[model samples]
Target chain A: MTASVLSRPRPAVATPTAAKPRRRLGPGRAIPFGAAIGPVGLLTLWAVGSAAGWLDPRTLSAPWTVVTTAGDLIANGRLQDNLAVSAQRAGLGLAFGTVIGTVLALASGLSRWGEAILDGPIQIKRAIPAVALIPLLILWLGIGEEMKVLTITLGVLVPVYIHTHNGLRTIDSRYVELGESLRLPPGTFLRRIVLPGALPGFLLGMRFAVVGAWLSLVVVEQINSTSGIGYMMDLARQYGQTDVIIVGLVLYGLLGLISDGAVRLVQRKALSWRRTLAD
Target chain B: MATHAGGLTATRTVRVRSLSRGFGDRTVLNGLDLEIGEGEFVALLGRSGSGKSTLLRALAGLDRDVAGSGQIEVPQNSSVVFQDARLLPWQRILDNVTLGLRGPEAPQRGRAALAEVGLAGRERAWPNELSGGEQQRVALARALVSEPELLLADEPFGALDALTRLRMHHLLRELCTRHRPAVLLVTHDVDEAVTLADRVLLIDEGRIRVDLTIDLPAPRSHRQPQFLAYRESLLQSLGVYQTEG
Candidate 1:
């Protein structure tokens, strides 16, 4: 038994193999082209349809008409002014909602009494979509900047609370034990262990919050007397200016993509220590 | 209680009197009393539900949630190394070692401990970058960096492959010899107990059933007659007697 077990073949170390050189237009390089194909294809089809006079120009303007209208809006400074207003609303709402949601999540997540007291109301609030609160908000705050900003804030709150709370609750018990064994103070434990452990969830929540912020802005700005992309779209809808409406939509898409990209960059930097299977 | 054994008069690093712990209606540790002398290496052998881990957790003050009545005297400064390395996934290797530690010399001591565990130049690497054995080595470095008086290990090498387990056993023995910290190693492996511990304990039904001293020389060999004798005795205590036709 001794000889056989002792002389058993050891597990071999994984040798570092020379990486095969990637081929041109490989799968890695093909992703961007694949992603762009659908949008580009749709645009080309629109252009062709318009050129062939197969589609009604009044319903959907040609792509070039939308581009020139966008240029006109930009030259007249309406696009910039409206875009600044929308940016301010989204930024303010996102900041306030993120702060409130994170604070609530931390309070409830860390203490049992906090969880018992706060979780029920928050869960109920999550169930009632933020859009449902628009009528009440309009009544209380009027259809002004406060109402618009508050609508976005309401939209941003739920995702941040849910994800961040889940992250805090699911921290590994082993780490908590380590904290106890080391006799770490409460502040140090929260700062060093709890916060960092909960970051992934917080970041995930931020992604959802970003989308929510934009959606709420779209809904709120459409209500009354607003200077934003949504307001421009509403005005264009009245005049049947589909080209201007499309420009507003394109700007919205661009902003969404840019904001999501920024969040992804932050995620990458913050979670640098993680080694996933893809790595 | 102090015991004079084998000419050494080491103070007790751990003392438990009438320690009783239960989960719901089931008792895991029943009125157990034990003592571990300073710098002594004690290996505890037990079955799956024999409360070996419970005892270790209790000594490490990690069993406060358990329902128990006992007087447990553990040193204020003691460290625990679990089967999993439990390094924070977000921190660098050196930072993980120095976790929960403060003072100007912490980084220096952390680096020194990493060097002692054969992980000298890998300080900036993340925990996920290391292999299973290497991570366990980092765990050891983390535990020893603080210079704890008692080190509680719950099957620290149980997850490793056989070859790595052997190497870990050698490394643990060396570390114990050098640091001279009282160690309580809970494991199911009989050979591991025979090879590494100064004293081997068999726990059965939440009580110590066999307490035997391994008086073998340093660098103990499995082929030795005395080593086999100890192994056979331990196996018998665990109710796995060898059969001869």
Candidate 2:
């Protein structure tokens, strides 16, 4: 009976050949193609509308006209000058805001007294959007480079504080117990465990900060800036130079995408230890 | 009645005098007193919520927040292995073994301990990459690498499968014999207590109810009549009697 049971063949089931093989695109290979489809389709529609004379060139410039205008601005050094000014403002503001936010998060997350003092004020500031401070900032700092950088800094601070503080507070207590049992020194505990555990949240906040920097720059630069992409767009609006305006908007979108991509790359490298279904 | 083994010998590794602990009017460990000798293997058995874990935590000096005070003594160099392994996911296997250790030879010593636990050549693997049994082995290596004077294990093998638990039991026995640390294993399994412990204590209602010594020979077998008898008596003390004829 044992030999017969062992020798018995299994019943027919769904075989591998039953399912047809389909071509599926991996994410890495699909990205460029996926990214092209949206802008390319929109540009094609714009070009067709301009060619058929259904859209007036004064209201919405043709795709080719915007490209030629971008070329002209680059040759005259107008685009480069404004882009350089904006980049410096955004970079300096990001550095200052990130440092202050991280220090505040660590202080509050690690100590009761720090939280008791800092939490109430930070929450009050968070409730009031940074844009609401622009008029007050103009009254004080007077719409120079200082005012623009300060606006971006305020915009960057809120997300960094919220995400990083949440990360530090929510570290697994089991690991904390391990550290306690081993009697890890405070400095070593913070360096090895707490900081690395909070890095993902910090990077996520940075992505938000990058976008916020641009949003704040758009408003602050338009207010009274002598230079920047927003100033160029405002100049174009005065003379109805729609093509230059389109170029400025496109540059802003590209810069936002590039900065966010840099943060994501750093996040992937730092958190390579994590495993999830998406991987 | 309480039994006292009087004498302040240098070999006495643990000494607890009237230790009492409670949580918000709910008493967990009520005036419990116990002592353990050097290089001794003691198993604590209790039903769920009977204060076995609380007593073990007290002995490990990890119950600082609990109410009530008592004189509890333990060696300065001690380690604890929790039920969940608790290896840091961010660290490699070798780093986890040498966690909190500072010396020029610490990494080499960690490698040696991993080899002793049959986890050689897997130093660079992440904690999440290992199986449950392998993770527990890493925890054991981490605990033993420091050459602790007292090793407090809180249901360390409670999450393992039967076969893995059997293997771990043998491995733990071998390691304990070689290292000779005073071990206090808190477990709920009667057979596990009978198989591994030199002395078994049953805690009930926040106190030690039964304290019995197993005088069986080394390399004990469950097939032996003495082993079964100890298992039966200890099970009965825990209010579990076998209904088998």
Candidate 3:
């Protein structure tokens, strides 16, 4: 061999080319206060527009006026009272919807008989928008708390049922074999395999459920209501108190954002095992 | 139990008689009969759709889908190691090994089994944290944790790399020597059969085409004449799990 050939560096790494393993991206960390960037930018735009006389308070209230109005409402306790009522309504509806969705998902997901009995009707319910039922609900319940709460519950449950049922159906068949080979008891199998297998789907559904709750809440509370953030906004509409309407909108936005964040935090903790560590 | 020429009786741990399984119009296991003596190691070799996995599944009592009729006598205390580790990804390693095991000593037994597979301190790690070979080791630990009377493996090392498969063969031999469970390893590798099994059964057309006994020692060299002789003989059953047209 020539001296040049002998002196040539061997291939940089002598690793086998067969069976390429996926490169891990390593641990991921979100930037501090990254989520505030968009809202802050929007606030700055609104503040600048109102300060420069580009925005009319009649058309869209200035951001500072809305903030001041919020502070005034808090000082006089109107914000607190309406917020409490809104929170209570949302909380009750969320609990009822989540529980019903979970129970129905279990009933349909686990057995053929259960699926036959429950899946079709639930799927049909899923096809129809919850808001479309409001007129019928108003006729029956007379636009009371009953109608509003039920609307929220209906909106929240469909996504939960859909995602949970999908998760149950898609559990790996290999795990089922493993369960059988291990001879796991019914209780252990349900707790260890079935529940965990469906958890990701349940969490995914909750993400949609929270949004659904808020969307339905907005609709129901605006319809001749005496309480809630939506009611306050509607009341402001009558006298052109645009600042109070803006305040109500801000509260709704914050509530929706915070509730979603809360569910995401739970998801992170519950699914921490799914994150692959540095290899 | 059957007596040998030397007057030693062999206690059969498994006995399958006239088993026939079919899917639609095609039969996979047709009148298959087999027996495994106590503590004996057997390897089964076959092509794709040649009834190898069918036989293993039947013995594992996971043959609910296949239509079959036969008497299968398998011990209640049995464990299986599949090609994939099939470890629950959400569970820690120790919990995976100890799954379905009962009593107070279960955790301790799980630890010892993990230690036996040379994964002493990895009990808390997730299954995905380990390499493919290590995950297979965990599967082995899970299988042997219960001190089963019979161990059925369906290409347990088939998914590993060449080097990993070699290491696993040694680990399996060492574990088998210590635990002495009647093991039935199903694989497509002819060389693997000669290196591990006391007997290799070749199944074709849903029946035993050949039954070759390996008279070699533990950790048998693939290069040895006897080993190659065994491989050369069995290599006639070609196809890497290929299906018939």
Candidate 4:
């Protein structure tokens, strides 16, 4: 898709910032059971290795062992508690970041002065990785849930702000003219033109933001922590519990997959008008 | 049909005097003057850089900030159609038609307008789902839906294939008769202007060079002796003297 975009020069009207045009690209082919093939194969290999005693349990836990360990942790309620804590942190961070990012994007995207003031700082923030600020955040806010959530929010905000802002900037001038000719009031103009035009970019940013949230959560939970799957894995590492640590890894992977899927589903439904290469 | 004379004093739906617009040291429209009486269909013929669109934009008030000074007066409820349909892709067909319109009656009016344009029962279709002609039809539906006193179309059918353009021309004439809006259609096609317009204005050097009124009978055709004459004159006006073949 990027290659096609790079090779073809769009008309002067579609500037560089226009929500990446994927015009008339037919819905791509889907393979039967394609998504499941890799993971299923990996699980099968792990089970086979464990059953055949070829894999050392300390170094690598079997798929079944990890599952049972997860079950054991759940039965003891420690897993549920830690899972709840992790969920709250990530959810709060995502929600807070989304609101802040969107509002900031609107302010900056709509006005010249706002852009001059906010864009430079935001771009600077984009350059500084969220995880890199952990030490400073820890020193300022202490190693609490606030610091963790703040870090995740910072991680998620940049993509949302950047993409949404870009979307705002690149709305087709034709539509602006149409709105003006029709004499649409300011509210209708923003609701009909500005919001919908920015949606594709906003949704694209969200896909990145969700992943960023998980990325920040993974690192954030490890900071002098008492809870979360990350903390569980840390504790397991001290005791050399391979199965428990594997369970933690799997949980993080599953969370990342599920949240990303949810965001994608919303993106598809919201911007159904868009004909992109994605399913 | 009683062809409107230059003296038709019922109402001038549009009038512009000494309109001037420039683009970075290059003037596009130079002291242009124009007028269209109520319900009159005027076709503007000009070469690519002849400032036809700039004038239309000025009339539509889309270039209020972009264009230079002009004493312009047009109906407040005028609508415009561009070369592309310019339908909001995200909105459904019905929504696009009723876009800026309000009140409970707007939807009913939108539906009626769509039906008039032969697109009934397509209210739920997406703009992208439709063929190029169909999208332009929706654009027409939207333009006339408001019952504007004036309609400014900037090559609305320019993107269509020849057959579709013909169909649209028929639709446009029929709709204009029913709605009775003063129409200013900008086009490069001489035949299109001679066929559909009550009057054809040839624009050159940012001003109207020739304003010729059509006194032809109904069901205008290419084979008509007057039609051929009008087309020849318009082609010559645009600087193409004759066909090589």
Which parts of model 3 have CA positions greater than 4 angstroms off?
A1-38, A139-142, A276-279, B5-10, B237-245
- Residues B102-169, model 2: lDDT tens digits: 87999999999999999999999999999999999999999999999999999999999999999999
* Cα shift from native, residue B186, model 3 (Å): 0.3
Cα deviation of B27, candidate 2, in Å? 1.7
> What DockQ number belongs to candidate 3?
0.60
Q: What is candidate 3's lDDT per residue for A100-213, written digit by digit as tens?
A: 998899889999999999999998998988778999999999988999899999888899999998989899989998999999999889888998999989999999899788
Clashing pairs in 4: none
Mind giving the per-residue lDDT tens digits that candidate 4 earns over B20-103?
A: 899988899888999898999999999999998988988888886674887998999899998999999989999999998989
Q: Pick the candidate with the highest DockQ.
A: 4
Q: Which ten residues in a row have the lowest lDDT in candidate 1 chain A?
A: A21-30
Candidate 4 has a DockQ of 0.62
Residues A106-188 of candidate 4 have per-residue lDDT tens digits of 99999999999999999999999877899999999999889999999998899999999999999998898889888899889
lDDT of 4 at B185: 96
- The alpha-carbon lDDT assigned to residue A145 of candidate 1 equals 89
For candidate 3, the docking band is medium
| Candidate 1: residue pairs that collide | none
Alpha-carbon runs more than 4 Å astray in model 2: A1-36, B1-7, B242-245
Q: Indicate whether candidate 1 or candidate 3 has the larger TM-score.
A: 1
In order, the Cα lDDT scores of the candidates are 0.91, 0.89, 0.90, 0.90
Tell me how far candidate 4 lies from the true structure as C-alpha RMSD in angstroms. 8.8
Of 1 and 4, the candidate ranking higher by TM-score:
1
| Greater-TM-score candidate between 2 and 3 | 2
